[model samples]
Target: MDIKDLLQTAIYQAAHKAIADGVFADHELPQVILEVPPKKEFGDFATNFAMQAARGAKTNPRVIAEAIVERMNETWMEKAVIAGPGFINFYLKTDWLYTMLADVLTQGENYGNSQAGGKEKIQVEFVSANPTGPLHVGHGRGAAVGSALVNLLKAAGYDVASEYYINDAGNQIDNLAASVHARYLELLNQEIDFPENGYHGEDIIDTAKGIIDREGDAYLAFSVEERLTKFKEIALQEKLAALKADLASFNVYFDVWFSECTLHQNGALEKTCQVLKDNGSIYEHDGALWLKSTAYGDDKDRVVIRDNKIPTYLAADIAYHRNKLERGFKKLINIWGADHHGYICRVKAAIGSLGYSPEQLEVLIVQMVSLYRSGQLVKMSKRTGQSVTLTELIEEVGTDAARFFFIMRSLDSQLDFDLDLAKSTSNENPVYYIQYAYARIASIFRQATEDGITLSEIDHSKLNLLTTECEIDLIKKLGEYKEEIIDAAKERAPHRIARYVHDLAGQFHTFYNQCRIKGVDRDLQLARMGLALAVQTTIRHALNILGISAPEKM
Candidate 1:
């Protein structure tokens, strides 16, 4: 059970009893807000219920606080005191902590999961990068954040679908085709001018060579137009395969790889524009169709179809979102790069104009990531000459460190990924520090078994022996696992889980230092062992949510 929630309910009951007892016959109790005190001397948890009910009581808050404390029937509270401004503080008895430890051990991997979301259908679309190049560190960060958010939402009982929108129908694809053709000509000693906007990565040249190995100058037998189409088709397939392989290696898998070309082929864009016209949200001027997005909070009107009779990218996006809503999802969440911050208003406006509440769509902007090695910025990728690819970063540091570091900070804040620190196995590495705690607990269990002690023989009744400050603090932290998961899911923030695991690990280390398990009295040793097992179970569950591994040996 959530002790804070339970205590809040008890406090409300006390206030009700005070009202029935005629202490505040004229008052209606306000909602109770429970908060942890900054200092231990203040209490375990503090609430402002009495202060909020003062107006209804027509008396000073301290009077109401005293009345409620007198009527309180909290069996788990050691004591309750009134602080300045009538804040009620509660110190919990040891039974609550003991019960929490048992709960963690019983729940095991399902410790933090909840049914709070009621299984609302939600779709998270992220890392929809163009299929023109390999994914960079920025894409990697987005992938990590998106995947972790999916796990968090599922743990909170939301029905979620993860998607990647492939951009394969635009000028970028044409440039890719031209670039590959240029490389093929160069390989055959035929002079050709490379397009200025063409892809220059070595992977493009490699793709061209692979085509030559298969066809062998057969492309010369066809017209340049046909060759361009063939080349575009070949490059798109190859790039998409590589993208899928790289993301899978990083442990990110998508339920859907939605294609932009499908939007045009199926006439979804035209259908969406017609819907906007029917709603009078679109107008035509100068042979171009424009959307009055400014009517729905956008800074300015946006063009849906240009003078050349071609639909803009914005047109396709609107259709995509409409498709998502029509698919019966209650909410749509998009994770975009920080550079797209200005794009959020227009998208939300479009959704609003499509007759849906703007609040139905949520956009999260992932800020840029800078890589540092030995205190110096690593500017360019040796392969692409633009930015370091995600594959390179994963190869340099293992997948665990790469995924952990990418989300170690808030999504809106700029992140500096230190290469040297990530590779270190020492305690300075946060991932290693958390994993080591799990490993240490495993070592203790192994040693115990060797000494002819098994968990089955442990005495759980002696748990009250764990009254040390460190031991209590560790159990209290374990109790917060469910709340952490709920808060992270509600806020759409995965970094909170990472921060929680680190704090839990720190508490376990402190408890290990202050308490002894081996060679202690039989009852005391078993109690501590049970606590250790609970800590291990909780840490593993948290790491699984973050998409990080909890190793038995680090």
Candidate 2:
């Protein structure tokens, strides 16, 4: 159970009773409010219900606090203290803390999962990078955030679908085909000018050679345009396959790969345009079809179709969202890079004009990831193949460390991923520090079982032997897991989980430094053993949510 939530519920009950007993007027309470005192002297959980009730009672806050304390049951807490100008603080009994360990043991890996989001269907679309080249560090940030967010929402009882949108029928695809064919001709020792706006990455050349080796002469005899169409078809699939493999290794799996081309093929784009046109949201200006996105908070009108009749990227995106709504998702979350911040208004405007509530869509903007190696910026040039690829980072630092490092910062904050720091085998690497806490606990448990000590043999009532302040502090933090999961899911901020795990591991490390578990006292030994198991379980669960692994040993 979540102790904080439980305490909030109890305080609400007390306030309600006070109102019913004519101690305060009705409708005076603020629904619910709970806060932790700034100092330990103030107590574990404090509330200002008395301050809220004072205006209703037409009296001072201290008088209301005294009367409420008189009515509060001592069974729910050790004592009630009204100190420091009428703050009603509740100090839970030590027995309550000891009993909480049983809850932790019973919940185990599910200690923090909450039912806060009910059963809403939420879709998260992220890392929709064009399938023209390998994923770079910026894409890595989105991958980490999106993957972790899916896990968080799942834990919070939301039905989440992780999705990727492909831009396969766009000018970018044409450029990719041209670039590949140029590189193919170069490999065949033919002099040809590279296509304008074509990809220059050496990886593109590699794809060209692989394609030519596999499909020789069947494409060589065709006209350049025909060959390139096929070349792009082949190269786009190949690049997307490689991208998927990289993401899988990084522990990101999507529930759907929505094709932008398929939407156009099925006439969904035209249907969406007609919906807007029938709603009078479109107009013809300068022989070009325009969307009045500016009417719904967009900075300017966007072109849906050019004068030549080719649909713009925004048109495809609008239709794609329409398809998403058709899929029965009430809430849509789109995670984009910081550069796409300006695109948010247009998309929301289009969704709003489609008669769907724009509030149903949530946009999370993930900032860029800057690579630092040996304390210097590492420049990336796709043409030179000198930039760091997501695959290379995974190979160098291992997937767990790479993911942990990438998600350590908030999405709005630019992440400075230090190559040197992440690869270190020292305490400075946070992933290792958390894993070490679990590993150390695993050692203690293994040794305990080797000496014929089993968890079933320990008595729950004897848990009072764990009275150290450090022990109490660890349990207090463990009690916060449910709240953390709810906050992380509601905010779409997975970095908070990383931050929480680090704090829990830091407490465990401090406890290990101050106390020894294997001793002559059996009850103390069992209590400490249980604490170790709790830390191990917390570390494992938190790492699992972040798509990182928690190994029993390094």
Candidate 3:
């Protein structure tokens, strides 16, 4: 058990005892707010339980605080006090923290993982960008966040499936094929005008020339319509392949690549529409098919099919969500860009119309990332094909730096990715700072082993000698790991974990600067080595959770 759990257990027992003593009306346990004290003198953990209990007890909060403080009797309990505004602060004994190293060594990488998630079947759909072009920096940020969130959820004991939605059956495919044809014509010394909305990137020219070289004149025999659709399908498959390769290079692999074209091919789209029609959630108006999304808190009714009898993209989305539910995913999470905020309500309304509760679906909209080169925004040119791509950014700065930089901020908060800062791979980079701390400990351990130090034979009682304030501070921080995981999981905020690893690294660095681990008596060396080993274990586990690598050497 972790510190938060330990404190919660005590709070529950105290609340129950107070109820038995007729100090409160209902059996409802009062709210317990456990937080680290602002100053080191305040102790390890502090709670404001008495301030909340005073209303029920009809007395001064300080008296209730004193009453609760008088009841704590665990072995770790060192002292308790009632501070200003009636808060009960806990100062834990040093011995209690010394034993935590045993748990760290025994658990290893599994130190922070827990079974508290209750095992829900969750599907996280993210980075479902169109395959018409290479992914940009915006997509990279989403990829990092989505991958890290999946790992965080899995560590919390949820059964998670990661998915990437492919938007292949759309007008974008037609434009892409036309662009490729125009590029091919240009390559053959024949003048051809590209369509107004065709992709103009140089990559399209290369792909077109490749297709012409491989397929020769075989496409000439087919009719115009047949040629266009076939070329579009082939180009889309190629595009998806390239995307998969790029993501693989970044260490992001999805379990599913659900194609929008699949829904249309299998008649599932039409069938879902019929279900909505039969359920009275859809109606006809002005020769157009409309869904009554307004009944479920949507801003207004939306058209599923236009008056021209062509289904809109909304119709396809409804079918896709229905397919997700049909596959037995108890929870569906979509990581959408913030620009799609308006789509959330209508989609949830559609889910409700499809016989599933709106609660089953969740949408997390990540804000945009502002790209800065030397503290200046890089303007995307309209004519020149010099837009920044994910591959380009990764080439400039390695994948590790890109991934860490992308996830360093909250998803909802707009991020400013500094190119110069990310390119610097030294300790100036926060990623390297954490990795170097782990590396430093690994180096020390290797030196200790080579000097004939045997960690396994170290006596357990010697661990109690780690009574320095800096050492105990680190133990207190380690004790908060479980709570950090729970908070990140519940809040759907993986950035919190990233921030936590940096702070832990900072604590380890401070401890390293203030003390020496080796070159002492055998017993002192063993105790100090145990502390260093615990720090190494924590840094490794934290980096693993974030889907990052902790190098053994700088």
Candidate 4:
């Protein structure tokens, strides 16, 4: 058992024993929650178990704490003291550190892997941007967070499927087709007015050029309806292909590419509407179908079908979620842009009206990303002549730096991405800092090997030599990897892993500075080598989870 399990088990047994001995009135015990003390003086770990049990037992908190501390693991725990009105702080012996270090070395790359998720199936849909243009910086943020979330969930042992929902059935597709037609006519020296609401990105012109090169004036001979139908299919294919390539370059991939049109084509949208009608969750009002979303906590009822017998976007979304549940996923996670915040309530309400709990669907709203260069807010990419594209960002900074910067904060918080900082190779750049930690350790091993010293399997018995303050701090950080991944997965927060790996990097940097690994005593050097090996392995795994690279040599 880990330190947490040991303490919790001991505390539970002590509380039960206290009640049995009539030391306090019999009452239910409170759940134990332990946290590392913010400062070293507070002890290694702290818990408020006594504070929680005091009220139920009708006894003083210190008295309850006294009862719990008297029964902890004496072999590993040096002392358990009561502080600040019943919080129990545990100061542990150093022997546990040796054991933890040995475990780390043994586990190697799997040190942080946990089966906490119990293999429950989960679906994460993200970056469902329309195919009208290249993905902007905003979409990049969602892609990074979404892909990292998928990786994090899998690391926590979930049966995860990453997906991209294509908005192919909407007006956006029409606008794209119209835009391509206009560009195609212009390229062929024919006069035609572009649709006022059409996409105007440079990509439309490229699409027109590509079509002309592939089939010169062949489309012009067809009827306008036939030509539009063909263009829509061709443009969507090309746009999706380009989108896949860009995401692949950014190290993001999806298991499914679910199209919105599929819901309509397979009659799922109409089927769900009929189901809602039969259940009285929807009604006809003003010659339109309306969902009574207000009953399920939405601000107001929503229209599923308009007066023209056209299904609204919300109707398609309802069908999509039902399809997710029907596929047997226990949870559905959607990463959406911040502007979609108002749509959350009605969508969740739709899920409820369809006989599923709204809790099954979770939406993460990703805020906007503002790029800054030379202390000035950059609004457009000179290369694209529009909003900065993900491709542009990757080209300027790099995939590793871009992914790291996008997820440096929570999804709800707006990000001010510094173009200058991310490009810099200095310690001020956080991604470079973390990557350098891995490289620095690798260089140390190289130096050792060059001196005719070959590092073998870690001698677990030599771990006892690691006793310095720096060594303990590093070892403790190594032990924290498991808890960090578990907590990060529980909260659906990948930013926590970013923060954790950065902290781990800081600890390793300190340990390397204070402890001499090479030219030290043979046993001490081997112990330090074991520590360095574990730190490097954990760093690589953490960076991999974030979809970033940890270069062995910077």
Candidate 5:
């Protein structure tokens, strides 16, 4: 149950009744916003409905608060008080806490889920790393964030599909081919110049070596153009396979792996260009076709087709987004690198030019990640040629730590991933600490089972005995789980879920330390056991959404 929403509804009903009874001579009511007060003594929840309605009601806010409070039916609420210029504070009875615990138990793995999204169809495209090199640390961060966001949206009842846009048909592919060809020649003891912008990753060299080992230099007799084309095809497949393997290892899986080449082959690119031209959004300029993006709030017009008759990346992107819309997705969310922030307006402009609201597309820019080890930046990797590969990071820190740490910070904030801290087994490691809470709870249950107590035999009637400060606080945190997920989904902020689970784990630890479960009275022990199970359920749900595991033992 959403307590804040419930309280808001109650307050709205009370205010509406008061207005109908002519207590306040207002024909219109302001939107009610309920919030948790900064201090526990203030109340469980505080609302500024009265203050907001003051101007509409033409009365003092404090007086309006009094009118609403007097009309409020005290069913779930213990009492209501008017405080500080018209805020109404509500203290709910302990019965809601008992109900919350029961809900957690009943919901099981879906304890924190809700139907807040109304089943809107959303497509989340992320980690569309170019098929030129192995996925690096930054790509790993995007993978983690995007996958978790998909999970978050799904839990909130959205029909969400995760997608990866493969940048296969680009100059980058040509460069990859060139790099592989050069490496192939090197393997055969032939001298060839590698392009300055060619991919120099160790993986590319490995691919080249594998080709030579299998084909035995037969390609040397082929024309350079044919050789480059064949090599590009091979390298693309290998790189894509490696990317899939690494992402799978990190527990990041996409529902669709979309090929950029398909856009061109299926004539979507031409179709998109025709739409732009028909809508007067494109113009021929300087021997090239340019989209009049400036008319739609871009910094300037952009080239859709170059003077050489090659469609620019923007053209392909426009077609990709249009294709997404044509597929009947209600929303499109793209997780892009921070460097693409300037590209947002143009993409949005393209959407607008295509007769769709720019609001239909949302772009989340993920900032860069800097790896630190022993207080020093570690940049290079032997496995991925130059940059640290996501596979290597996973190998070092494990998938759970890699995913948890990647999303511990907001996507907009640059992350400093501490290698030492992530691998540490101490409480200083946030993932470890959270998992330890789960393990500790599991141990309690195990001990209970050994003592001839089954979970079904627990005396749920004694749940009201859990009235200590820590117990109440823990229950309150558990109640906030659903709200946290809803807020995270609404804001497109998956990091909020990470923060929530961490905070919940901290609260559970506090309760575990303060309340004894083993030697207490059977009634209190059973009640505490129920609470522990509820916490374990919540932690598991939270971690599951994050694609992280909640271990039964540390």
Candidate 6:
């Protein structure tokens, strides 16, 4: 159970008691929603339930709050005070913190685990960038955010699956084939006109060069259509392989790799459009099939099929999303680049047309990322014939720092990544600072071993010795782990865990400076060691969810 859950239960019982005892007339009760106060003086946690229930109870908010607090008899809380506007601020006794530290030590890495999601199934599809080129920084940001979110949802006890949708059946593939063929002909010293608006990345030249080395001039003997078809197949396999490898290097792995080609095959796209028409969510105009998206709050009706009987990209997407629904995914989460913002409404409208609630599909848009070095923006040139590739970013700043920096900020905001800070060893680097905290704890254990103090067993009674301001603050931060995971998963925000772990590290740093373990009394020494183990467990657990590592030796 979450710490907040326990607090809420107590507050609820108190409110009901106040009603049963006739302290206030009860028509209905509002839910107790607690928030961590902005300042410590406001107490450990605060709730505005009194304000919400004031009108229903036919009383002032302050009177309702006072009634509830007067009846809140939970021994875990030291006191509850009424703040301005009838907010109830709760200050907890240290006894609960001591018990929580024991649990943290016992549970270890599972300290932050919870069942808040109730095992509800969800699918997260991200970085479905076309295989025509290498993944760039935009895709990298999505990969980092998407993968971390999957990990977080699972931690909060969701039945989650991560997926990568391969955009292999489209104009992009044709352009790739034509570009590779042109590059191949050029490598053979033959006069060739490159396909206009084709992929101009240097990776295309590399692919052509690789094909020639393996097959030699044998492909030249085939007809244009046959050779181009072969290039399409071989190039897709190679490009997809490289894409998977690059993502793997960043610690992002997908459970499923769905192909767009499958949606286009076997009359799937047409069948989906027919379903929309059957539901009266689609119509025809000007010899083209159109989706009545505007009826569902889209800017306007969108074209699904052209007059020439060819389906547009929107048609494929509609079919693809329907397939996801048919596969029993209760929820579908798509992580798209910022440019796809306008498409959200149409996609949701397609969901409603298919007889499903548009709310079932959640689209997370990852904004742009700008790299900086030495206080100047690190300009991206036509590297790999495009912006910075994911591989280049990983090689430059390392996987851990790159992933952390990408995830530390909210997804909806533009991120300015500092290249020099990521590469630096100073405390200003958040990743370095976190890992150093873990190392500092490990160093304490090493020193204790030399001093012949062993944590063979924890004295449950000695846990009360952790009474200093620093120790109490660290315990409070550690106690927040489960609550943090619950809120982060519910809000669809993985950055919350990043912030929580950073603050936990900060708390431990303060504790280390103000407290000593090796020279303390034997009983106190063992208690502090137990606390230290909890800190180490939580840091590693939180970092693992972010796909970052907590090193014992900085």
Which candidate leads the pack in TM-score?
Answer: 4
Q: Which residue runs does candidate 2 get wrong by more than 4 Å?
A: 52-63, 83-86, 381-386
Give the runs in model 6 whose Cα sits over 4 Å from its true position: 1-3, 381-385, 450-454
Compared with the true structure, what per-residue lDDT tens digits does model 5 show for residues 328-437? 99899999999899999999999999999999999999999999999999988764447888888988999999999999899999999999999999989999999999
Worst 10 residues of 5 by lDDT: 1-10
TM-score of 5: 0.97
**Model 1 per-residue lDDT tens digits across residues 218-308:** 9999999999999999999999999999999888999999999999999999999999999999999999999898987788899999999
Candidate 4 runs further than 4 Å off: none
RMSD of candidate 5 to the truth, in angstroms, is 1.4
Candidate 2's displacement at residue 170, Å, is 0.7
User: What is the Cα-based TM-score of model 2?
Assistant: 0.96
lDDT of 6: 0.90
- Per-residue error for 84 in candidate 3, Å, reads 2.5
- What local distance difference test score does each model get? 0.91, 0.86, 0.84, 0.91, 0.90, 0.90
For candidate 1, list the clashing residue pairs, or say none. none
Residue 177 C-alpha lDDT in model 5? 93
Each prediction's TM-score versus the true structure = 0.97, 0.96, 0.95, 0.98, 0.97, 0.97
lDDT of 3 by residue, 418-501 (tens): 878887767688998998899999988898999998668566677887778788888778877877887798788889889998
lDDT (C-alpha) at residue 40 in model 4:
89
Error of 5 at 248 (Å): 0.4
Ranking by TM-score: 4, 5, 6, 1, 2, 3
Rate residue 112 of model 6 by lDDT: 88
Encode model 4's per-residue lDDT on 1-554: one tens digit a residue.
78777777878988888778777778888899989899988888899989898898999999888887765556788888899898999998888889888988888878888999999999999999997779888999999999999999999999999999999998999988988988999999999998999988889999999999999999999998888888899899989999999999999999999999999999999899999999999999999999999998887899999999999999999999999999999999999998999999999998899899999999999998999999999988887668889999999999999999998799889999999999999989999999999999999889988876656845899898999999998998888889889889888899999999999898999999899988898778888988999999999999999999989898
In candidate 4, which residue pairs get closer than 3 Å at backbone N, Cα or C atoms, i.e. clash? none
